[model samples]
Target chain A: MVDPKLLNFDTLSVHAGQHPDTDHGARAVPIYQTTSYVFRDVDHAAGLFNLERQGHIYSRISNPTVAALEERLAALEGGVGAIATSSGMSALFLAIATLMSAGDHIVSSSALYGGANNLLATTLPRFGITTTFVNPRDTDGFRAAIRPETRLVYGETLGNPGLEIMDVEAVSAVAHESGVPLMLDNTFATPVLFRPFEWGVDLSYHSITKFIGGHGVAIGGALVDSGRFDWTASGKFPTLTEPYPSYHGLRFAEEFGTQAFLIRARVEGLRDFGAPLAPQNAFYILQGTETLGIRMQRHVANTRAIVEYLSGREEVSWISYPELPDHPDHDRAARLMPDGCGAIFAFGIKGGRQAGRKFIKKLKIFSHLANVGDAKSLVIHPASTTHATMSSEQLEKAGIGEDLIRLSIGLEDPDDLIDDLSSALRASRK
Target chain B: MTELLVRGARVSASCGGREPDPSLPLLVFVHGAALDRTCWQLQSRYFAFRGFSVVAVDLPGHGRSEGPLCASVEEYADWLAELVEAAGYHQAHLVGHSMGALITLEAAARHPGRISSLTLCGGAAAIPVHPGLLSAAQNGDDIAYRLMASWGHSRRSHLGGHPTPGLWMMGGSIRLWERTPPGVLASDLAACDRYRRGREAARQVGCPTLLISGSQDIMTPNRSANPLRNGIKTLAEVTIEDAGHIMIVEQPDRVIDALDGFLTGL
Candidate 1:
């Protein structure tokens, strides 16, 4: 009986969520690809349905392989539980839906992945849930944004594109003072680089499609509950504290205690919304997660080398990688994420948008893509791609510019990446 | 959730989504120290739906129950006896885990006619708390919680494949312990340590008894329960493979199955 508390992060990454198959002596996590499980009898079937027993009944609700990945992510992040979703967008949507009702409100960081921005600022309002967006650095702005109906304070660990580091401890304090939970999108800085729960963060979600999955082969997301937040104490979340009429008037907070949010999110959110991660995708993501600790080290090292190389290039106007002393959030990043700031960062090309286009076109090794956190290096221009949905004013508010080029540093040789960038910078010159 | 008045204090118990029916055979569940009724959610609800009327009580000063913390297992046993009567039951099937098992044993011995049957899960004749653990818990140190949660489950449970989908068993256990009211855990641990009459009480228990053990239960190994097995008049034992002290949550179905057969037979 080895105690899990004594296990190291690396050891847990590989073994935390799985064991040797008892049915078959398979060493790897077997992908349970079925849609439903066979019940031993009617009593057994009723037991599962009534939450009297612990077992998977339907695929959309829970699958064994997906459950393995959910547990692994929860262990890595130090959360009580996790629910995997079809995409990072779905995870965010499910979290918002689970917490918010028609008249609820949110306080959010202005610097966010564009999809998240759209969801908070645009789509949610259509359903009567409103949001107040503040700069990630303005802790006071978050405090002032709280309405009586405010249920959540949202931000990213490393802000998308801008790479602004959130002061999580400070923001979480503000959220707590207002009786709200702080949720961070930890996709940019995976658990390998940062565990949000160790700080004051109450909830966290991820796009496992990126770094966690390593390969860009899968698109998945997960919502993790720190189980520290007192939803009952908050008194604002009726969904958790009050009896739910759907499940025989079961109150989630009373029934599940610390795991109230996650259980409700699964039994209600996943049950009705119906966006679950495929077993095959979960298996692929699990493969990537096993090597996360080592792969992230390489990713961070390569990013540092590339950041240093870009600083000396005359074609580069500015960089926002947080490790640089001049970067606005460098000090905070150092204090919070001592292991390493993540690999994805944004920089400017001297010749503006046209030059940025040519530089991206000229790069031989870095693939131009709409995603980050891949095993291979990737580059994207947010203004024309990811953030294209946003208005010019929205882009400016998010600190995105025409010349801004985002790079997702990979595990390739640092010298090779630099060589490719060096030639692209020269070719990008007028 | 049912609210009962025991010893002039409010006591809460999960009645499996409905009020306990006096018509059905009463099944009362008692949770271990520093834990509450939710620990037996799966079992209580399962039995509640299947012909048995279940009431998994939150011990005084634990969970939603309101009262002063019991100073000893004997005090808790007195409270348990009164609780069954307050819930309108003359005789009940008693099921308890860890510290709760000790309480059930003492209650059955002291008020034998009130308990129709008794089931002990991860229990021993004597549970002596380590001095270091006692001191740490006294100070409300996190190490006590970490140690308890870590030692309570089997090594296999550390790597997750929780029968319950999406729940991390270890993390959930720690969180539940963290929610324990300040001073409550230390008091409960002290009470468990002070308990010295378990074997004697076991001999006095004349009810049909079942002892449930987990093969991987490090906290209360099978050998630790030798005194109880020998002392009890009529005993039935079931050892769940690869389970630990918290077998109720670790192997819920197995625990339920063991109880179902034993109680149904009675």
Candidate 2:
């Protein structure tokens, strides 16, 4: 049998998971606005509910409009399957819920977003799952942290705010040797700049609200399975390897093979958690994904120019970017994501905390906001905003500095963004 | 939802539960050439719920089943004979697809004691491999996988509307075939091509048999499947329209309903 030709990524971005509605002859993906689908017959309805067939029974489980976005994202990432969630936070939670239950553990990078850090350290323990946070730089710590109960090794392609680079290939080796999957958060790098799956990371997720969505308008996330992990071989994840009593004695691994993890995440996690992506939001993300590659290229190009401008300024006390030659993980980032390190990173101001706030307040064009990856530039002071409730020790442990100002470079002209930063720096000084 | 290690062959299967219920009839599902047991997902889940203990086997050396690749369809059949006993079942109702069907046909004929019956979905009395396709698999060319997957499904499947809501059936099938380890596909294709005993073995089989053929199947058209009807006694044929070789996915509901109905009658 000859194989069907697959369109390249750029082309797939435009067409991968969609086709014209044969009945309606609509050119664009119609919003499957309804919550339920009409079954052809009683047997057909039973077939869908029992997972004997693959049609949508309910929007909360799977919807056509959202399925289009999910399939497109899965194609873009080269994953076997994907489950779209309400937000990146929900995606991570869904992944964890699918892989483990009470008594299981995870080893994660200490350098993480505040919300993730809290979820791992505090919130999840209340649910009986626990985490061991490790320094991403200590490659050995990842291996050493593995316990018999450890189900996954977690890291980000680019650590939030700090831009700390996780050695994916190196960490993946540790994870595989320990017989657990490695899940990476690739929101910052996106697939255009980096794909953790290529480095042997078994699963990856994105806050599509960021690069994949390319706009801050939609708050959604996606979890993708590389279809590479062997749960039965590992003999650790009973969740995937054993029949779920709640789901009618259905065994995910036996039923879905390589895609067992993702199947369970959708069948159990999304169904029970009820954090399904709205069809409207899914369309918004789909529109953004269509031009992800081009937008990311422009964002990276503008970012490098802005970083260069900031590095030469007297008002900047220090600049932290993996692209900087002197950065600790510069070589590693270059090897893993040659396209770019990321569009968001942190920098320290010469005048410290008070001046850092003034500089952000002084920017006219760059909006001071909590979100990132918008077409318009944005700035945030993590210590006062995302991490305000944390104590000094907690903030320091997370690598968040009082003087650090985080910038998420946008698609604006590089010179305009640079000029705005230049004026803000001058206004905040003496 | 657990791993079952078949003794001696070191072959493993993804089983539906921690332990197979002895009182229940065992349904062993084998995959097509260059594919894994996951292809039978819809059937396995449905059968498991229908009071059958299911085990989707990753043929020796494919998927999770560590392989010293079985040299021929006969060898694979012999291995299944042992896997049934090793899996602690008195006998198994064997279901195979494509290359797997050839193996099941041979096993039921040779080791009838370990097999309850046979169900061949998308199989024929003889399979002739395209020379270029065989050459591609031999070279471990990924193009061979794509070619096989593209031709495996009907044109309607190319623009997919799988019963499953979100899956791009064609893309999923391509990715599945691409996961075959080095020489597995080449060996599997050669085994199917060289197997000369399918029609002869069907004549020797002393059990009920079912064939679910796709009306639009280009790989094993009606002409290819006709010889089987002449060879087997008490045989049944159910044809699903608008489906190709991969009818299990292209028209999963129809394929599944046929099996469910046949088993219920049995």
Candidate 3:
């Protein structure tokens, strides 16, 4: 039988999660612009709240447009379900909060977005939830970091600055052996380039603000549950396995089954914190997603040209891209994300921090920004911007050299991007 | 949720809490051929919270359940009886859809005292198979699945309106069939066509029965099930409008309301 899920990536991007709006015949997904849904009756309302039916009640809990985006991402990632959130950080927070409570712990990859690093190193600790950070290259460190109180193992699909490509299958094995689920932040490698679930990673999230919403017009996030992980077999997550006071003591795992992680994130995390993606944002994200497959193709091709150009430039000291043979994870990237490692990578210039700032100022086409995965080319000195507050020792540990320049390649003509970087590099040296 | 290895077949189920009340009778949901437990997800969760132990199985060779596909309805019924017993239940309320209904009917006839009550959806006792469909399935042609998915739904369902948000009924129905192994459907269709015991099986059912018919269901419409209904001395029938053979996805609320009322009455 031809599997419905076997449809090619390009086909699913446009047609996966939605049908035309039945009420008005809207071909495009409608923005369901309302705060609450009117129930069929009071009994219907009770049924929705009681988890006896599957339908929208409150916008904060679930909205039609947002649900469509959630479903689209789920289909893209081959997950049981997905929950769209206000931002990438909220998606990460929701996953952590749903899986754990006060007095719990986590093992995480230190090579992460600076914001996420702060959350795990600083903010989560204040909430009585602590983390043990492991070097992204150190698989043994991740396993050894686990304590009896550990809830999950967290890592990035591509580590910061250095482009550390995780051996997802190997790391997941260690996690499963200890009865824990491995979660990956797949913002850098969108589902078009890589699906973590295919590599045995149980849960994953993406910053829709990145390539997914290619135009960078919306700020949103998606949390995907692979449905392959057996939470019951782990016997550690009481939040999923045990009954709760809310919703008449319904244990999510027992009732929701494969979609337990997703349902819990929506009802408990989104319901309480109320960090939901606006229907408008969801619509924008969905529109961007329709072209995600094509956009990533251009993004990757353009990046390769830029990488090759920089390698030959005398003003460039070193290049850090997974496709480069000398890079530590080059072979792994070829195996895992064979289509492309990603469009974003960091490199160093002949000069130090001063010249890096000069290079950023000289570039006319490359916007100076902290964000990656935008349609317009962007450049930044990560050590000065994203990791400015971390101590020198912490900076060294994160592999963020003071001279490193991170570039987010765009869909512009490769000649223009390479020329713009070439002139900027010469100008910085002069 | 429970995953058990019952006599070599992997049985995946959803029940009440970690441990359920033995006094409260169990309701076990069986899916049609070429579909798994996910089709019943919406209903199972609802019933789990409604104070009953609800179990929806991914019959052998489907979804997470492992198997060398049973070639007949009787073999499937025997497995169901053993699964319930393995889960420590003496009796259960059997809820079946399409091919699943034939299995339940056979189980009722074979083990008269094990089933407390029976609920059949989108099914008829003598479910005759289309010859072309059977031939295509037997050949394991990919086109067979596409035809089954497209022809199985009512015109309204083909137009793509699902009661639930973020779900496409046509896409969902197609995926369910595609998820099953190649030759399972052909064998199941053959088993249904050979079973000519609708009236006899219905007479042996010694408990109340509920029949949920889709008003527009071309696969097993109300007309096809008339004889089965006549055989049941104690029975109730409900026909939901604008729904097809997959009534659960088309009008979940109405189906649940009718089923809930009947179960509550019992």
Candidate 4:
């Protein structure tokens, strides 16, 4: 009976959620590719359906391979449980759908991934749910925005593209003061850099498509529950505290206790939404997670080297990496993410949008993609791509400048990366 | 959910989705230290739907029940006896786990006629608390939770393949402990430590007793239950392999099977 708390993060990343296959003794997690499981008998089948026992019945609800990923993510995040989804967007949507009903509201950071912004501002409004967006740095703004109908307060660990650090502890305090749970999108920081739960966050979701799945192969997401929120105490979340008619009047909080939220997300959200991660994708993501610790260390180191290079370059006008003393959130980032401020940052070129385009076009080592957290370096000019539709004034309001070029540093040799950027910088200036 | 007024405190119990029927046999589930009725979710629901009435209780000051913590196992036993009667049961088949096993033993010994049968899961004749663990819990340090969760579960459970799909057993256990109010764990540990009349209680219990042990239970190994096995004249025993102290969640199905077989025979 060894104490598992003694196991370190790197060790858990490798061995947390899987054991060798009993049937074939396979060392790697076997992909249980089947869609359904056969029951032992009629009684066993009944027991499973009624929640009288624990086992998988359908792949959409749960699968052995997917379960392994779910458990591993839960362990890594220090969460009680997790649910894996087909994409990062689905994980976000599932949580929202499970927690919010028609006539409910959310308080969110104005700076968010474009997809998330659209989901909260545009799409969910069609479903009768509204959002109030505030600056991630404004802790008081979050509290002031909370309505009696507000059920959740949300933000990214590091604001998307702008590199603004969220004061998680202060904002989480505001959320809890108003009797709402603080939720964080931890796609940029991953648990290696910042564990949101330890900073008073109640729930966190990740785009496993990013850092966790370091290689740019799989597109998946996961939502983790810290299981510290008391749903019944607030009486705001009837979906969890009251009887759920969908599952034979089972009261999630009563029967599952701290696990109520994640259980409801899986049993109802996945059952209806039907956006489960494929077993093959889960296997790929699991493999990526095994090397997460080492990969993140290199990613942070390489990012530091690039930030230093960009700071001294004649073709660069400004930099937004938080570790730089001039960045507005430098002190906050140092406190929250002492290891490193993560691998993604933004900087301004000597020229504007055209220079940004030229610099991206000339780069040989960095791929020009609308994504971050890949093993290979990635460069995206948000003004001409993700935020291209925004007017100059709108871009400024959102903290994205026309001259801003976002860089997601990778595991490549620093010298080769610096050389590639140097040639591209010269081309952009000319 | 059912609420009963026992000794002026509001006691909460899960009735397993059905109201107690006077004509049906009664099953009462008691959870271990720092845990609640949710631990008995599977077993209680199974029996509740299968021709029996179930009451999985949250002991005073635990879960939904309101209280100043019970100071000793004998006090908790007396409270349980009152709760059973308040729920309109004359006799019940009591099922207890770890600290809960001690409570059931004391209850059966004190009021022999009220308990029809006994099932002690992870029971021991004596439980001696570690001084360091007691101090840690007394100060409300989270290390107490980590130690219990890591040691309570078998090694295989750490790499979770939970019967409940997508659940991390060890992580869930820690979260459950975190939900308990401060000082409750220390109080429960103290009560378990102070309990010293297991052999006398076992000798006095005339009900058909079943002793369920986990093969890998380091917290309270099978050998520790030797006094109960020897004292209880009509005792039957079952050992679940590869299970640790918290077998109720670690290997729920096996624990259920053992209970189902034993209760059906009785």
Which of candidates 1 and 2 is the stronger one according to TM-score? 1
- Could you tell which candidate, 1 or 2, scores higher by DockQ? 1
Clashes by residue pair, model 3:
A254-B1
TM agreement with the true structure for every prediction: 0.97, 0.88, 0.84, 0.98
Please, what are the lDDT tens digits per residue for candidate 3 over residues B121-179?
A: 88687788778777878888756666766556666565443445434455456545654
> Model 1: per-residue lDDT, tens digit, A388-423?
999999999999999999999999999999999999
Per residue, candidate 4 scores C-alpha lDDT tens digits across B149-172 of 877887777677787777778888
The predicted structure with the larger lDDT, 2 or 4, is: 4
Model 3 segments more than 4 A misplaced: A1-6, B1-28, B31-41, B44-72, B75-93, B111-117, B124-251, B261-266
Residue A88, candidate 4: alpha-carbon lDDT: 93
User: Clashing residue pairs in candidate 1, if any?
Assistant: none
Candidate 3 reaches a DockQ of 0.27
**Model number with the top TM-score:** 4
The C-alpha lDDT values of all candidates are 0.91, 0.84, 0.82, 0.90
Against the hidden true structure, what lDDT does model 3 obtain? 0.82
Weakest lDDT window of 10 consecutive positions for candidate 1 chain B: B12-21
- Reference-based TM-score, model 2: 0.88
lDDT string for model 2 (A136-202, tens) is: 8888999999999999899888887898997788899999998999999989998888877778989
For model 4, the superposed segments whose C-alpha errors exceed 4 Å read A1-5, A388-394
Of models 1 and 3, which has the larger TM-score? 1
Candidate 4 similarity to native, TM-score: 0.98
Docking class of 3: acceptable
